[model samples]
Target: MRIFISSLISGFEQQRAAARRAVTALRHEAVMAEDFGAQPNSPQIACLRGLRESDMVVLILGEGYGFVPPGSTLSATHQEYREARETKPVLAFLQEGISPGPEQAAFIAEVQAWEGGLFRGTFRQPDDLQDGVTRALHDVTLANATGPVDERDMMTRALAMFAPENRNQVVPTMLELVVVGGPNQRILRPAEMEAPQLVEHLEQTALYGESRMFDRSLGVISGLDGSDLLLRQERGASIRLTEQGSIVVRLPLDEPRSARGFDPMSGMVLVEETVKERISIALAYVAAVLDRIDRTQRLTHLAIALRVAGADHRGWRTRAQHAANTNSIQMGHGGVQARDPINLLARRAALGLDRSALIEDLLVPLRRQYPTAN
Candidate 1:
């Protein structure tokens, strides 16, 4: 596929070189379009026309590198998004650690509404650049193909997509998912999202622990729709529901192996022997996951991680609409209950998931980090 790089040419020199090499390594003919940076109005428009001819646009984001052009409102990257809105495709690669600052987010929210494309992780260096870009591009390709993408799938993929070393950032997504897998494929809806469904399906098939987690998450059928609940497939992902439309928690996932290493941060680091010394990163991953994960299994997974990290384990209580703070207090640690609907610890009610598989991903590392009592 033909790809175009729409970036400010002057200040972001290092980013430019990295982009060129990365795109070259990906074997796509690359275009710099430097004249646009010098004279953003006329020349940039001409460059955009050139980019319009390409199949995909790679937005390299930065701060103070103004290329938004006079009279026109959209930034260079945002404009390219519109350029491909009706046809072709595009993906944004924002700088890591740069949370959408107010003006930036307001500016982006407009383009995000205008164009529907996947924006991958924030990249810092050139070493992991190629892999990161490739992964993001592949996801964008999938998302472009899938359309809007299942919200849960996007975050699930995003958390795992980046270099686990930089696990400090808090990256979240739109929806929740209760996936299942084996013989048939399905996507769960918010109302239909039940942890029991996942547990029962895996049990009937006699699936093992890791297999259950891997397989169950793979076979999500459909999500419930209403006021405050949602579950969906992220756009552009190559997932197909069976013609029957039954919420059957059975089917093979496109990539099962990747799910094996699946530990998207729960607001904490993915700590283990291999992670070196990213305690801070782990802490961040755990903290973010604590807030991001709305499902019970994920919450339990969070609790397990906190415990393994040797934390003062505290069950999540929906103290307020805001966040779960350290100062607040709650009840129980072993599992869940039926009453706590919005309760993160209420495994069955909110997450609607069974005990083992849902919590397994977060717990396995804990087991590896700290063995159980005999």
Candidate 2:
């Protein structure tokens, strides 16, 4: 992957260097101003070209907004970010405790206010930036590998591919293989997979076959393992899923049936009301699930971070909508505006429920109302 590193040229030279080294260590190319050489073209043109060429952008912001290019409104760095957003994934890192000029502050505020799933965080030092980037890279990889699936299908498919002979032992053996693994921890133990089935499958895939279905399936499941759906941990020479893994496992999701706008036999359009009803129920289910998740969840935290920029007297539902827009978080079915779980959390906080207590004291009761979900 080619990663474009964007930041002000001054005051961030070392940080840029660190980022380049970090990207190189990951065996990915880093595209930056230094790579452009003494091009006859303007720096702004060069920067925009690099941004467009890259697969992802790592935006590092500090006190300076950098120089504005001739005939352009935004500073070069800001312009690059805005342009990159149209095509490439952006991972923004803000230097902590920097007092920016009013213009720079406004740009940073806009970034903070964005309603998309662009990853952003604060860093105090070069090392902090490197660590944050590393984590972001892992998240990007997982997201690219597989779009979200309900947990049951994720696990069932994992077992069928990894331990095919022991497919009946899906949940228990998966608990033994991946549930205990967390980020960067031991993720799988083929030996502990009940019959060495997983190891043999990989060995056979590598030795034969034009396309390795086992590898493809393992890639998606392992991506889930990295995403905290299966908490990875080192357990005495093996790895296993943590307790949270059990809570997430559910009855296998039914495959969605293909639907058409018009019925062939009747030569009539399907009832819009029926489609709307199905969507409504799904929205309710989502609301119930979100209501159970604690405030510490990333979506909730992102919403709170927006408060610092200004909540604009918006209602919680509106705020959540804006957050979903800004952060690429899925909100709900259209026309099904159930109460947002994050809003409930903010209200509970206002009522003097401690942040730590909100999940168990408030959210858990809501979860019990939807017991099957819990």
Candidate 3:
């Protein structure tokens, strides 16, 4: 497999070379920015292109945050790492026994917080990093040899939990999120979903200190097909826990009475803040459920999907636009969906670390569907 090596060039020349040697020794192609002698595009573009081409990424974090180019908020190394985490497998190595600068330290913390797509280690010298990389790559290869889980199939199963007639009659202008554990993860039994602790965790966890996502007053917790658990709300919001270890949350987004002044028949208007809050709540609930089922902090492969349905002729509005009473930009699409498999830490604390970035990643495709403003 081809691997991309990403790091700051000035401070970690030795480490980069060590990583390259390790990759070559394993008979893998190591792609680095230094090897690109001359390219028509800028260095950032070239580095990202190399990263996109590679199957895996080896990220080395040092004391410096590297150079932040003009018109970019993040350093090149930071950008590369972000890009790699979204798609390719990443093996991250942090330089130990040294104090990183404020920005670099924050970046390191952010990376450590990410619950998905990471194989992390620490090293004091180039040799240690090289050995770690070799071992990590071997582990990843073996894991891949088992074959990847079918994310589309998992999504289909999750969606099937909601009956077609019920979905059409009850859930309109809804945000549906599903998280399914991969084959390697533990398969939750029907009894586990009925555990008192799990139900309490779902009802008690507050989304914003006071507002809870699941309340007994608004919903009823019941059994489904003798194997799955369902929490159906009166207001069209619901949560389904399947024996196959999938958590599906459906929240209605359209309330014509609440969002007055707009013609409800035209389409739904999605507020940025409202959408963010709902996604955050759904993820928090998923994390809580995972924690309740299995206490292990080990990485678990998971397939996650987010879908916005009944979105034909929909519109999206930012907070600023809403305050100014400006019109929302038309989505020009029927529905939006995003699905990807990830290796996650499966803990609430770990999910909190990169939750915003994860949410943004899921929203990117939907955002792109909106027409450009004049």
The top-ranked prediction according to TM-score is 3
Judged by whole-model lDDT over C-alpha atoms, candidate 1 comes out at 0.39
Q: Write the per-residue lDDT of candidate 2 for residues 1-374, one digit (tens) a residue.
A: 99999998787888998788778878889999887988778878888888888899998989998888778888988998889766666788899988999999999887765512345778998998888888777766654443333444433433332222222222211111111111111223333333344334423332233212122222222212432322122211112222222112211111123474332211111122222222232222222222233212222210110000111111122222332443332222233322222212132111121333432343333222221200
How close to the true structure is residue 311 of candidate 2, measured as C-alpha lDDT? Answer: 13
**lDDT tens per residue, model 1, 1-374:** 67788666677777777776777776776666852455645766777787877877776766543556778776666666667655654455666655655556775555445332124446776555556667766554442342332334423432332222222332321111122111121234443334456434434332233222223344433333322122222321111122112111111112222445642222222223222212222322222222222211111221111221111121322213112342333323433222200111221111222333434444343334322111
Of the two candidates 2 and 3, the one with more favorable lDDT, higher being better, is 3
Q: Whole-model Cα lDDT per candidate?
A: 0.39, 0.46, 0.69
By lDDT, the best candidate is 3
Rank the models by TM-score, top first.
Answer: 3, 2, 1
TM-score of each: 0.38, 0.43, 0.51
Cα lDDT, model 1, residue 163:
20
Off by over 4 Å in 3: 1-171, 184-186, 206-211, 215-219, 255-267, 297-299, 326-353, 370-374
Clashes of each: 52, 20, 0
